[model samples]
Target chain A: MSAFNTNNFSTNGYELPASVGASLKPEHFASILHTPPPLGFFEIHAENYLVAGGPFHHYLTQIRQNYPLSIHGVGLSLGGQNPPNLQHLTALKSLIDRYQPAVFSEHLAWSNHGNHFLNDLLPLAYNQQSLNRICAHIEQVQQFLGRQILLENPSTYVEFTQSTFTEAEFISALVERTGCGLLLDLNNLYVSCRNHNWEIQPYIRALPLAAVREIHLAGFHREIDPMGEALFIDSHDAQVDDAVWALYKSIIQQLGPIPTLIEWDNNLPPFSDLLAEVQLAQTILDAYNTLPAKAQP
Target chain B: MTFDAAWAHSLLNPDAELPADLRVWNHSDPAIRFAVYRNNVVASLIQALADSFPVINALVGDEFFNAMTAIYVRQHPPRSPVLAYYGADFADFLQDFPPAASVPYLADIGRLEYAVIQAFHAADMPSLTTQQVQGLLINTEKLAQLQLSLHPSLQTLQSSFAIGSLWFAHQGAGNIADVQPEIPEALWILRFQLAVEVLPMSAGDCQFLQALLKGQPLGAAAESVIEAEFDLIRCLNVLLQKELITHFHYL
Candidate 1:
């Protein structure tokens, strides 16, 4: 019943990122903003700026004037059984109203359980019950915010046994039912595929291309088993791997270029490293734009 | 419960029996993904707590912090998404923790740390001027009944142990044992301009502020402090200079 029509938006090739720089501290954020690369938009974890009239808010306002913004939320626990927190929704709505970010997104998994807040993205069962629940939660959020939200697929160490629907199927169903867009994190696809011993190509191919409005590329850590089976960690602390970049190329080649963000959260390097990754992403995005007519979307 | 709500219940408690109409019950791999979520939810909360209460974590060590956080997470999950304010109840959790009981001061330390964090994020506002204070004293006799408003982010705490010393030490100052803990300490945490700062207050100063905070006018609050060896003039100057007292109301 909301007026957030996703498929009919002006596609006229919205500005695609060549690459984007990322930072956690406000001083570093200000410094990065002043010397922004071609893809100038900066993304921030929404939880960091939830405060009112503080230094963080002050710096964000200063930065907002110069660059396009994206609010990537780590909370909201959309897949949990509990209804979305009305207070949290109100807070997010307040942020959206203030920033008017180019994109607003949260993960498919739940972070809070019952009355407890876990502060991490938990996995959800991909079943009809979950599908309906997530759809309803998404509907409530969209209706309340009065705008469409892009839901990102979560990185996982395990898959739910009760999931009747495949990851792609669950995503497509969500787009169909709630009209929410997808934020495909190519690194997450690679991470999930490598962990679950699945083929990444089919998983990427199965995504609802038209619904994907944003792309996320981040680094992952690897944990090896006694048998040398590698478990990829979705730790956003390092550089984007070559395999993930390859997947990004593959995704852009088919789905067309999307607004991309390069996330680096832990063991954060100096601004140059993040800017370099953003540049790397932009280079790939540009390559897709100039791909031979046969390869272009 | 509806299928969606039932699924939610199961996600929070893995031991909960699956609802009959739950969509995941018909899935080929429901438990696998369920386990992934279970791991994520628990791990994420544990990390948030660790991040917020670094001193508590450092005092207990990483292994201990992780285990204690797991128990704390299960017992006290955050009710709001504003994680900066999420661990407000953690101090209480430590007081009741059986393992933490050995370190009786742990709870009070958590309280002090929580207060500092609260003060750090409190709103920004200008304070009352000295001229305004002088004007306010025109009705000096009614000062006892006058209530003084404190900053939104200001937090005043009193503890029996050397919790204040322990906290300051953990903040790269010095060791807590180095500061003798024979006497109880009253502490004030406030944002003076841009940074949040913590300092110990004398018993008289503490009593004075607490009384004023409780709606007592300056006359009555100063009397309480005078009995406790506080220099009324000096305290008033400090309060005014620090911009702690925002407004005064005479009852």
Candidate 2:
């Protein structure tokens, strides 16, 4: 396996064939790999291909030759007090070396402590301490992988009273310190906003749009607590909610056509069904991309 | 305790108090908020265990399986972020677990399933080609020095019960209730073209393979099996046909 050279790809240089893609599913590997979907890219969870040899790596290697790849991780624990785990970091670095994904990204949350990894993207209190800890962690990760990564805004069901910075401010600070980019998750913005009765518009407005490189659109599930208070869950098990789609369209219109991913992790539908959703994102991206050069801001 | 420690403790133990440092934007009691995180953590780990040990889950119905996994996960949550490597100690844990005392074979079943899962992710190396293992001779000197190499994905599982039967029985094998506990069973678990195959072996074949696994040459292994009147040619044919022997050399 050869290392992916990040220098070869730039937003202004060689870009991904299509702006819209779906996270690669094992069920769709045969279809996508054999036919090689035109203008389609794939995103994968880095942990799934950590092993030395398996069907997962075989297919990913084959599919990678044609389409662009994005490596999304779930285990960085960037906001934890302890420094990032060296073993995990080494494995992630090996992956980056093996497959130079067009882009690499992880959550803006912590999922590890001491030696054990909790295996869930636990929420963090957005304060000065966490902001500093995460920036250092992201910098360490970037230095180790030899490339800057995009930190995504996480969806949470709760907030800390001790939080001194809003989620957007915290992300902005990390970007400023590390010179990293952002993978704006529109579904998360809507889910977190509705869960705490916060305004989505202001949160989106506060973000540094120029630093935004990719966008995530996914489905959500609704739940009502025992006390009859409504709560929305960011379960990527269904079609993208109409509300999240609306938010996504607005972000693209404001930020221009950034590469967007359609994440369907659970209750995965057929290949055609997932592609249909990808096409929907393609439609939105196409609408923004068609504006004349003189029609710029 | 620090915020992360307190937060992890609360999530691990549903009965634990909400961390004083933990708070929600809207309300004071954050118990419901805690529940959402707790649910995600517990449910996802249980799903991991079930996915790794589907045979165990099927042998014991979902209700009992879910109950067992729920207890097992809380007592021993994942220590690594890689969900693929989770539940390695489940078989050992089930042996001492009180609720599982009724089924002594349960531990062995779990052991078999864990191997199957591990074999799927084990390192890949090409098996020996046909030209490698040419012939089996009756001469003592020639056979004494030959050592067979197994593939990285090849593993042998020995259990006191018919775990292979129980495993297949769960996979639409009929009349499991009528089956009875029998002698020890040995299974050749390996990955064949992206699929895990569980091949049951007779006692003589298993002992011969076991001797081979211990780095013994063909003469010693053959002598042991020959004492039991095991057919050497037949065993070699099965092993050769399956491509289990990656390569062989004179010791």
Candidate 3:
């Protein structure tokens, strides 16, 4: 009954050129504007630019003019117990309209509960209740935005005892039900797999990879869990780990060059350093570009 | 409590029991694993406060600031997920925080820092052109009845302590030792072009601007400034030069 034809929504039409990009940081705004770097596109956290108007918008407006953008939302809390915040959703719609980004994405995890926004992506129980809640929320968001959004898999620390579906199965159902796409974050995959002792390849194979329109690569902090097993924290501070890069290479080899992004949020290095990481991902993407097209999953 | 409510409660309250439903792969104690989320929630909110109030953090040092913000984070977790405007109540928190009572000027600094952030993110609008301002200024009768609209970013703060000098001291523009914190100061903050500019304001100018901000007409605003040293020409000139006057219309 609504004006939007939600059934036709697909991320395939919104794919960025098969190349690499970096998270747009305020520190690197000047350099990015000084000379538009040789990157495919820049990804920005939607919450960072949710303000009315300022340097964030000022610089992003100019940068957006030159580069294809991916607006990544961190605050939607799609998996929360309640439905998505209508006010936040309205703000997101305005931002989407203003920017008209190539791809819009959000995490699968919930960051808010009740009146408090936890400020970190928290894990959710992948049971029927949560799945129903998340699917309904995503459907609302998609209908409100009138476009398909890619839900990035979260890097979580713990799992819930009540979980019925595996994380991959939960995500696959989300895509199937909401007609949403996946923003496959390799760093998160590595971190979650390492923390939970889940094998990486099986998890990847379980995901609805054909819905993946974008990929993210970031660094993680290594710590020890209470069980004395190695724990990886999804800290976006350091350079992308070599192991994550290996995972990314394999994913790209199979998927054949997705829009990969280098996300370095905290303790940001110079623009050159980020570009160096972008170059690394770009190297992998470029290598796959030359290969014969693989069969779509 | 529902699992979500219990988990949310435990995240902000350090001493609260962890949600009963949390689990790890090895069946090991989930306390440490769950602490990661608790730590992340508190530490990230604390970091947001520290980022917004760096001068306050520097004045209080890391250990004190972190500890104080931890309590504040628990007391007032952000209602919204946009961390950019998360610390709106931080200044008020510092005012009543017992540990920070030693630094009496700390709350004022928090206010200034918060104001700077507000000004930095306020809606962008073009300032009235010089010609347009002059065109209005020449009509004396019209000017008296005109209600001027300042830039959305313009903010004024009146502090009993020398917040402007203290802020400048932290910016390396002035010697910290030279700052006399006892002196009362009125500060004007606005984003001129891209940079947020902070300047010391005279008492009379502060009153006049505050009145103007409240939608008082030019003549009424000028009359409200009871300070003997209030120079109408000087304040008008500054407003014109700084492009703070965004628009004006006859009352």
Candidate 4:
């Protein structure tokens, strides 16, 4: 076992209150540093900062001092056939210790198999066998980090014929068994429901909504399947779609304010554009914040 | 084969049959939906390579680069999930790629680009100041036996082609037409604070620096390149200016 005792490490009391944030992009480092925006927190892909040290660490160190951070791991392969990688866990623990992020999350998808890491979030069969494997992985990760991790729902293109449990059932089971939280990605919920023809509201209601600790909203690309049915790609390139925003508003109204992040990864626009999206989310959050306590969830 | 092994195999190999027990709600051809994952896996890896080797992408047009990296991606999928260090073997791959034979310098450029990325992400260490260096130089006898530690971000690449000029050309600092590819060049790459700087160096200075990086004492490294016109003061000046030397101790 590693020598890191999570009890001894202090997270500096940084808390990500219910508000809006944005993905911390390298391009916007200058703007973020010069004029810090009124954001609840900032989220970063854990793999990007896995290196020993560099500007990624340098800037993140400075930026983290002012903002509550959320480290999202895209490479843990939580749903893979094998257990999580030990070295990756060690690195992740060190990063958490260094930055003391308020929250850490990963996907319910698998990206590694054998010796190859496919870089894309691949779908998994939601069966008893797979569920057991994922539960063990999540338990190991939580034990190693000494904190619960939020598993984000994946935006997958295909479904497995072998899956016995619905996506919501599988996620709910994982949350119940492992004592983990849910990172409700509204864009993913919208995209997966459209792709798989699953009912959106029912799917959201089916999930253990009370366990949702954070939310993600991003834009996706549109495509057509062979049957001429619409398919949405979670591309994270454009502005959040109107439909997704409506879904987010509905969720916020029901669940009250949650830590929301505007994720724009590729074809990045100026910092102001991301701030605009942040402002959009903040408006909805602020609206909910001002609501009477009795009216809130 | 197990489902994971089968699925992984099919993702990298287009011809491999899609893993059994895959479907969509429509039950239409799953191949079309499966193609999305295939495309994502291959295209994202190719994009990672393109991100790391932009000069290589520019040298060979996007069409050629994409096609070439497609082949490389299938042959060498990333072993680690860190996409930044995905193309460590790309330079060697380009060396033997028959289609890229016309551009012999492409492989060298790939190596240079990779080094730049490595330096960009290397560990941060406090560099020695000029005053500290001057203080060391004052003790001539002690300096000869002193072993200097270079900054964690310093990288030295010696190439037969004008790699430094070619890289700069792509960055809009110079014209590509003015680059004499056949002219030999040695490159010094290091990150000062936040920005990564790539500069050309003489062969003699490069050898001396390389020797110093290999833990050679200051006097011996300087002596090894003396016949190559290695100017100790000029080399020290550049090192001090760039804050490359991080620590020094007498052997």
Best by DockQ: 3
Model 2: residue A34 alpha-carbon error in angstroms:
4.5
3 versus 4: better lDDT goes to: 4
Model 3 vs. true fold: TM:
0.97
**Model 3, residue B169: C-alpha shift (Å):** 0.5
Compose the digit string of candidate 3's lDDT tens values, residues B1-251. Answer: 97678988988887899988777898878888888889999999999988899999999999999999999999898999888899898999899998889899999999999999999999998889878977897897777788999988888898999999999999999999999999999888989888899978788888999999999999899999987667788778877777888888788
lDDT score, candidate 2, position A129 = 81
Over B1-251, each residue of candidate 2 has an lDDT whose tens digit, in order, gives 98888888888888998877665555635787778888988888898898899988987889999899988888888887878888889999999989888888999999989888788887777777655455544345677788987766777787889898888777786568866757578777888767778888766777787788888888888777643535677777767776677777887
Model 2 chain A: ten consecutive residues of lowest lDDT: A1-10
lDDT of 2 by residue, A1-297 (tens): 212232222332334454898898878889987777754578999887877676788788899888888999998788788888899899998888788788889998887767667778889888888877887788788877777688899999888877999888888777777878888999888988888778888998888787788889999999865456657888899999999889887877777888889999988998788888989989998988898877645
Q: Model 1, which residues run further than 4 Å from truth?
A: A1-39, A224-230, A289-296, B1-39, B98-102, B129-147, B175-177, B224-227, B248-251
What TM-score against the true fold does each predicted structure earn? 0.84, 0.92, 0.97, 0.96
- What is each predicted model's overall lDDT from 0 to 1? 0.74, 0.81, 0.88, 0.89
True contacts kept of each: 0.37, 0.60, 0.87, 0.84
- TM-score for chain B considered on its own, for each of the candidates: 0.82, 0.88, 0.97, 0.96
What i-RMS does each candidate reach, in Å? 5.8, 1.8, 1.1, 1.0
Docking quality of model 3: it rates as: high
**Whose TM-score is higher: candidate 1's or candidate 4's?**
4
Model 2 docking tier (incorrect/acceptable/medium/high): medium
Pairs that collide, model 3 = none
Candidate 4 collision pairs = none
Of candidate 1 chain A, the 10-residue stretch with the lowest lDDT total is: A7-16
Q: Name the candidate, 1 or 3, with the larger DockQ value.
A: 3
